[model samples]
Target: MDRRQFLELSGAAGGTLLLGSSAAAEATPAVATTNHPKPVGAVTYYTEIRVPPPEKAAVLAKMDELIALMQGKAGYLSLSFKQTIGESTMGRAYPNPKKAILAEALATLDGTLSSPKVPYFYVMFLRFDNYDNLLASGVQAWFKANIVPSLFAYNAATTPPTKTSIALDFHEGVYTTVAAADRVNGYMTAEEISTYLASKQSDEVAGQYVSVNNHYMIMDVNREAHYNLLRENLNGNTRSIFRPIPGDAGYDDSDPDYVANGQPAAADNTFFRKAVTREILQNAFPEGEKRNYLMHGVWETIMDHENSHLDPRFSAGASQVGSYFIAHPVEPFYITLKQDRFIKSA
Candidate 1:
């Protein structure tokens, strides 16, 4: 069933079973409590690396080696590598390829940084227990001592060490779980919600959601009042909680379909469903013309890429939406919604 249908059925059931007057009264908090202790949140480090066309392979190999080395470090949670495919990387992939339809959609959405020149080959995410653990992990030192030298060694003969190029950008933040869902509905009691919220402050529950193909929303918000509001208005089936990991963090590196001998895994893209509300969609793409941008630009682009690698039917609509992204990479942004403000604005 589609996500909307499932939400409808589940929500109705939840209303009947859990939305009694007493429960409803208790659900909304009068004032945000400050007594609950804060949990140890995760620290996430993101690196956007650009490699010259000729040096891509060598750089990737060094990256693999570095990742392997990090596996042994204390407090290391997970690491992921995603190749950036948009305007920045397009020219390198196809010297002269046709512009993509999705490219037009992206252009319509935002003009800022519309034509990025840096050809980023990969974006890496590394997660650790906390900021202190991240500092003690020695990842930054290792990267500087080992990986940085190889990245610039391409011009060792002609260029001075300082003149050699090493193009990368770094950002760091803490993970805050905004939403968590399980298949079961109408099972959470008010007491359960309170306990869960309190426990989540210090618990590593993000991985649990990943294992069940449940949605986990991570953000940077630290206000206790914000979370209390979410707890107050949470749909019976949907529990909004913060995690200490990046929103895009994956649980494990093993292939999701390893058990099925490489067949298209049913669990490949099941964790987060597409947003059903106009407000949520608009938050991601504010432009009127780009209302359906996620469906076309993100979802369809991903499906096309997966199908190309897995299905490969010759007659299929082989639209290279993924290729279009090489020249027009999607910029990552955060969306924060306040329930009271949203309702008033609506």
Candidate 2:
């Protein structure tokens, strides 16, 4: 089924809504192409929710309701309560607002709310219209100042998660509608791209245990022809995916330079597609226990997300989802992951 058709399937039943179905309530969207630029004025939140197995479904339901409620409130934009993927610990960061909002809302409910003793992790993302609006608008500011700050106190807080990183992106002043995203170094040959990533020991790129192991190849394509054609086949809310940062241990500690100052250099699709595709193929996966599936699934999911982002209209905000979070300097080996609830352009 197409994207819209997939939305209907996400619903629980006739006249009933599930978590994924709730996010699909936004207006119908068009297709995307390689020519799309980073969205303008987008502020995204990256966090995780903690819940019990039995209550996981209910908490997720409540999260959908809270998201719908927050949308009604001022300054709130889009949000996603991402389901756990591959490994549970690696899915999303801890202390997510979906979990918190569920708890708070359930606290005021009747019988056995937040009961049955099941535990799950959830992250509530509250995207704003723009970076300025994130801090300026009271509705957005309230969540940051009042709601999101004290999240660390949660019982299931994933402290020092196996991985964590927050990503942010903004359109460069010199960027164009057709300018390609450039990140690989000056390597005319495939060997050079491999050498660049291999010798790369930057704390930002290569850190303890996990490393910047994936390459996302993005391009500019014809809008009406290729973009629209692809839109006809995207199933479910898969368009919600976007290029993720270098880390995924449930912490947003990735260096901000990747997205803040780093982007793929714009070039012909043939060159980028071939070069990035090669770089990704050549990179060595981390020798972790779940390396094989994680590497494959992570890259696949991320590529899917970036490709979906080709449709520029639906993703119309800046810093949508292709940069690393820059909360603090990398200390020694481990970087602290923080929530990027909204953008604050300087």
Candidate 3:
């Protein structure tokens, strides 16, 4: 129940719910237009990748042989390879291993999805419907003809890409949850506690990306095994928030009060329940296709990083908060990520 209560139930942005006009799609109040022509919006992207700890076993055997030689290509969605824990090849069963979650869940609009940010190294997300299908989906020729020469052929290379952001899914919802243990015994993984309950009931009760419903957990992980339930869920701020809303662009997250009198700016010290999800097996198994989705909610996401400082304007503007969020892209942040101060949990 964080991330601004999951974006206040997932809706409250400046625009999107599809209606561009027509007197505000019938005087736009919220929704209930009907008469067909609206189902087209769900292009969310997040990115980051480093991989160069000695080419982590040839980039993990050429990305598992290019995801098993393009298994079920055709608008592939969900793909992750975040690095930092020494660019893993799947050792330590991916625990405390820095970061890595290569997703792949597509709904097809025909190719082209590269650059969710491409910072340190890996960042891919291709959701087309505009920008000329992001340029006739060869998706920059499958990232320069197949994921950039298998990502620098071994010794970890590729790093010459930059993208601001390209969001356009006026709205899209998905929330089916279940949780328990919360008095802070620490443990979240029902798809990272249903993505923190859709990042806070998104738009509260209904709005933006709305679909799928089921939730119940009541209690499970806290019995005082020594206390660490996420440092009392970041002590007091209860659900933390600093300033991050607009399109949620490429977040590698860092600065959630960078461990005591430090970080501040764009902090995200791994908290959405503890990010962890890897399985781009070409949409895993959408139950024989046809837009079904939900195969164990595909690799839950959560990565408890831990870092809290409980206000002080959080380390006094922690290192320019990621260049002031890449230079304040016109500042909109609809639901106001809890009145941004760059979130705190200390």
Pick the TM-score winner. Answer: 1
lDDT against the true structure, per candidate, is: 0.29, 0.25, 0.23
Query: What's the candidate order when arranged by decreasing TM-score?
Result: 1, 2, 3
Task: List, residue by residue over 151-234, the lDDT tens digit for candidate 1.
Answer: 332343443313244433222222322332222221134333223222222111222111000111112132234344333333
Order of quality (lDDT) = 1, 2, 3
**Model 2: per-residue lDDT, tens digit, 1-346?**
2333322322212211111211112211111235322333333333333333434444545555555555454445444343322121111222322211221222222223233222232333344544344444443333333323222222223432211122111000110011111223332233332233223212221211111111121122222232232222221112222222334222233545433322232211100011121111210111111110001111212222233223243233212222221111010111112122221222
Q: Which scores greater on lDDT, model 1 or model 2?
A: 1
Question: Measured by TM-score, how close is model 2 to the native structure?
Answer: 0.26
Give the per-residue Cα lDDT of candidate 3 at 96.
Answer: 31
Instruction: Please write out the lDDT profile of model 3 over residues 33-141, one tens digit for every residue.
Output: 3531222222212212233233335544554554443333333322223221111111112333333331111112121223322212332222322222323333333
Query: TM-scores of all models?
Result: 0.36, 0.26, 0.22
Relative to the true structure, candidate 3 reaches a TM of 0.22
lDDT of candidate model 1 versus the reference? 0.29
Flag regions of model 3 displaced more than 4 Å.
1-39, 44-121, 126-135, 144-146, 152-305, 308-346
